[model samples]
Target: KEDYNRNRPHSSLGNITPNEFAMKIAMEKQAA
Candidate 1:
Protein backbone atom coordinates (compact mmCIF):
# COMPACT_ATOMS: atom_id res chain seq x y z
CA LYS A 1 0.00 0.00 0.00
CA GLU A 2 2.71 2.44 0.92
CA ASP A 3 4.75 1.45 -2.14
CA TYR A 4 1.81 2.00 -4.41
CA ASN A 5 1.31 5.52 -3.07
CA ARG A 6 4.98 6.28 -3.40
CA ASN A 7 5.63 4.64 -6.78
CA ARG A 8 2.42 3.89 -8.56
CA PRO A 9 1.44 5.74 -11.74
CA HIS A 10 -1.96 7.43 -11.99
CA SER A 11 -4.16 7.71 -15.06
CA SER A 12 -5.59 11.21 -14.50
CA LEU A 13 -2.22 12.86 -15.01
CA GLY A 14 -1.34 11.20 -18.30
CA ASN A 15 -0.64 7.95 -16.51
CA ILE A 16 2.02 9.56 -14.36
CA THR A 17 0.43 8.87 -10.97
CA PRO A 18 0.28 11.14 -7.89
CA ASN A 19 3.91 11.26 -6.88
CA GLU A 20 5.16 11.80 -10.42
CA PHE A 21 2.53 14.41 -11.14
CA ALA A 22 3.42 16.31 -8.00
CA MET A 23 7.09 16.38 -8.87
CA LYS A 24 6.40 17.45 -12.42
CA ILE A 25 4.16 20.23 -11.17
CA ALA A 26 6.76 21.33 -8.68
CA MET A 27 9.43 21.48 -11.34
CA GLU A 28 7.19 23.42 -13.68
CA LYS A 29 6.42 25.90 -10.91
CA GLN A 30 10.10 26.32 -10.19
CA ALA A 31 10.83 26.88 -13.85
CA ALA A 32 8.05 29.44 -14.07
Candidate 2:
Protein backbone atom coordinates (compact mmCIF):
# COMPACT_ATOMS: atom_id res chain seq x y z
CA LYS A 1 0.00 0.00 0.00
CA GLU A 2 2.87 2.35 0.76
CA ASP A 3 4.57 1.61 -2.53
CA TYR A 4 1.37 2.18 -4.47
CA ASN A 5 0.70 5.50 -2.72
CA ARG A 6 4.29 6.76 -3.04
CA ASN A 7 5.72 5.13 -6.14
CA ARG A 8 3.04 4.21 -8.61
CA PRO A 9 1.90 6.75 -11.13
CA HIS A 10 -1.82 7.06 -11.76
CA SER A 11 -3.34 7.74 -15.16
CA SER A 12 -6.18 9.83 -13.73
CA LEU A 13 -3.65 12.03 -11.96
CA GLY A 14 -1.74 13.00 -15.14
CA ASN A 15 0.81 10.26 -14.45
CA ILE A 16 1.89 11.66 -11.07
CA THR A 17 2.00 9.47 -7.97
CA PRO A 18 -1.05 9.57 -5.66
CA ASN A 19 1.03 11.14 -2.90
CA GLU A 20 2.03 14.03 -5.17
CA PHE A 21 -1.50 14.51 -6.41
CA ALA A 22 -2.86 14.62 -2.88
CA MET A 23 -0.27 17.17 -1.89
CA LYS A 24 -1.18 19.33 -4.83
CA ILE A 25 -4.86 19.24 -3.96
CA ALA A 26 -4.11 20.04 -0.35
CA MET A 27 -2.04 23.02 -1.35
CA GLU A 28 -4.74 24.25 -3.66
CA LYS A 29 -7.33 23.95 -0.94
CA GLN A 30 -5.14 25.81 1.51
CA ALA A 31 -4.55 28.56 -0.98
CA ALA A 32 -8.27 28.88 -1.60
Candidate 3:
Protein backbone atom coordinates (compact mmCIF):
# COMPACT_ATOMS: atom_id res chain seq x y z
CA LYS A 1 0.00 0.00 0.00
CA GLU A 2 2.78 2.42 0.79
CA ASP A 3 4.43 1.62 -2.48
CA TYR A 4 1.23 2.07 -4.45
CA ASN A 5 0.40 5.42 -2.83
CA ARG A 6 3.84 6.97 -3.06
CA ASN A 7 5.56 5.21 -5.90
CA ARG A 8 2.89 4.91 -8.53
CA PRO A 9 2.35 7.65 -11.10
CA HIS A 10 -1.28 8.22 -11.84
CA SER A 11 -2.47 8.91 -15.38
CA SER A 12 -5.23 11.20 -14.14
CA LEU A 13 -2.62 13.29 -12.34
CA GLY A 14 -0.44 13.77 -15.40
CA ASN A 15 1.62 10.70 -14.59
CA ILE A 16 2.85 12.06 -11.27
CA THR A 17 2.53 10.48 -7.87
CA PRO A 18 0.08 12.02 -5.38
CA ASN A 19 2.99 13.16 -3.19
CA GLU A 20 4.61 14.87 -6.15
CA PHE A 21 1.38 16.58 -7.15
CA ALA A 22 0.84 17.81 -3.62
CA MET A 23 4.40 19.10 -3.42
CA LYS A 24 3.97 20.91 -6.72
CA ILE A 25 0.81 22.57 -5.52
CA ALA A 26 2.50 23.56 -2.29
CA MET A 27 5.41 25.09 -4.11
CA GLU A 28 3.10 26.97 -6.41
CA LYS A 29 1.15 28.34 -3.49
CA GLN A 30 4.35 29.44 -1.77
CA ALA A 31 5.50 31.17 -4.93
CA ALA A 32 2.17 32.92 -5.18
Among all candidates shown, the one with the greatest TM-score: 3
Error of 2 at 17 (Å): 0.1
Candidate 2 lowest-lDDT run of ten: 1-10
Candidate ranking under lDDT, highest first, comes to 3, 2, 1
Instruction: Give per-model TM-scores.
Output: 0.65, 0.73, 0.77
lDDT of each: 0.83, 0.90, 0.93
lDDT of 3 by residue, 1-32 (tens): 99787889999899999999999999999999
Candidate 3, after superposition: displacement of residue 31 in Å?
0.5
lDDT for 8 (candidate 2): 92
Residue 19's C-alpha lDDT in candidate 3?
Answer: 93
What TM-score should be assigned to candidate 2? 0.73
Best by lDDT: 3
Distance from true location, Cα of 12 in model 1, Å:
1.3
lDDT of 3: 0.93
Q: Residue 6: error of model 3 in Å?
A: 2.8
lDDT of 1 at 1: 94
List the pairs of residues colliding in candidate 2: none
In model 3, which runs have C-alpha deviations exceeding 4 angstroms?
none
Where does model 2 exceed 4 Å of error? Answer: none
lDDT of 1 by residue, 1-32 (tens): 98877677776678877888888999999999
